[model samples]
Target: MEERSNYVLRDNNDIGTVQIADDVVAMIASLAVRDIEGVEACAGNMAGELMDKVGIKNARKGAKIDIFENRVKVDVFVNIAYGYNIPVTCGKVQDKVKTTIENMTGLTVTDVNVRVVAVSMPNNK
Candidate 1:
């Protein structure tokens, strides 16, 4: 299997160029959303889901990262836990992801787009 070798380059004149993997930002976003109360899980697309089914776990599964001109745009896919306000929860997600990524990477986060893929209901006992 081949690996994706994508990186976000940050050049530091006094030191050296810093390379941040695209997957690293995605993983950061994934962890950021975990603390939200209404978040069920980071839900990836059909292909990612299929890969998960086969035990090919992806650290950056549900988050898509785009970098250009030293700025970033991220799309996060998630399943909301049942009985939470969608708007509020998504807003929280957006804020958390944007802030977390910017703080960690020192890059300007242009946008954090949240897509609610599903509403997870609890299984009856």
Candidate 2:
């Protein structure tokens, strides 16, 4: 696990505190994307891939999370397996990711932008 800075935010009241980090959000997003069918992979970029190789799961891989005044926005790159409807798969990923993040983190998801980076064909192993 890479060292992540604490992302704590004071609640509306002075009663308690809330803490969350960028990596946590990314992990949630990656797992959410994997849960949906027809998604081959998250298509992690060079840095994310390198992190994974070292066993330090970046979680954010193909995901970029931006926090703005407590509202979160995510952009995810995806690789869809051949034979699936591009639009349908993208929609599912978007819905799943948005709902998952909102429900799990209790943060307002401004958007979950799905970028279809590449298409991959199934392997005959």
Candidate achieving the largest lDDT = 1
**Which regions of candidate 2 are displaced past 4 Å?**
1-6, 9-15, 45-60
The model with the greatest TM-score is 1
Q: Model 1, range 1-125, lDDT digits (tens) per residue? A: 73554554676889978788777878898889998999988886664576467664452377877777768989888889899999999999999999999899888899998878788898772
Tens digit per residue, CA lDDT, model 2, 20-87: 89878887887798867899888666544654576544433777677777788888778898889999
Candidate 1: segments with Cα more than 4 A from true spot = 1-9, 44-47, 50-60
lDDT of 2 at 121: 86
* Span of 10 residues, lowest total lDDT, candidate 2: 51-60
Could you estimate the TM-score for every candidate?
0.80, 0.77
Tell me the lDDT of candidate 1.
0.81
